[model samples]
Target: MDTYITNKIMAVITTASNVSPGGAPVFKCQSKDDLYSITANLEAILDGIAHALNDEIYIIVKH
Candidate 1:
């Protein structure tokens, strides 16, 4: 079987100001619409899945 990345976080999208920088890229959006839009685009571009941790946070992950 071919090996591939699994259960890895590709990016972080959030509107919260307190979300400090860390592992994976973080995208801060001004509005909910922008957040959702960026998250969707990142998901598609990264070939990952978008999982909303909350109303203001979204994480793109690969599995």
Candidate 2:
């Protein structure tokens, strides 16, 4: 099982623009069971951060 999570972090890096670079999302898991647990935790964290930010978060599953 493979899990992917992408979340936008910063909005701007320098005075160039407010367009922040895409954050390299990550997940931690060993097997199917661990995958589920890790994905769940990541979802919760992303949920909280997304609530007060203009960023996008997504999850993808591949077998």
Misplaced by over 4 Å in model 1 are 1-3
User: Residue-wise lDDT of candidate 1 within 1-63, one digit each (tens)?
Assistant: 999887999999999998976988899999999998999899999999999899988999998
Clash-forming residue pairs, model 1: none
> In model 2, which regions exceed 4 Å deviation?
1-23, 48-63
Candidate that scores best on lDDT: 1
Q: Count residue pairs with overlapping backbones in model 1.
A: 0
Could you tell me the TM-score of candidate 2? 0.36
Assess every candidate by TM-score.
0.90, 0.36
CA lDDT of every candidate: 0.93, 0.37
Worst 10 residues of 2 by lDDT: 10-19
Model 2 / residue 11 / CA error / Å: 17
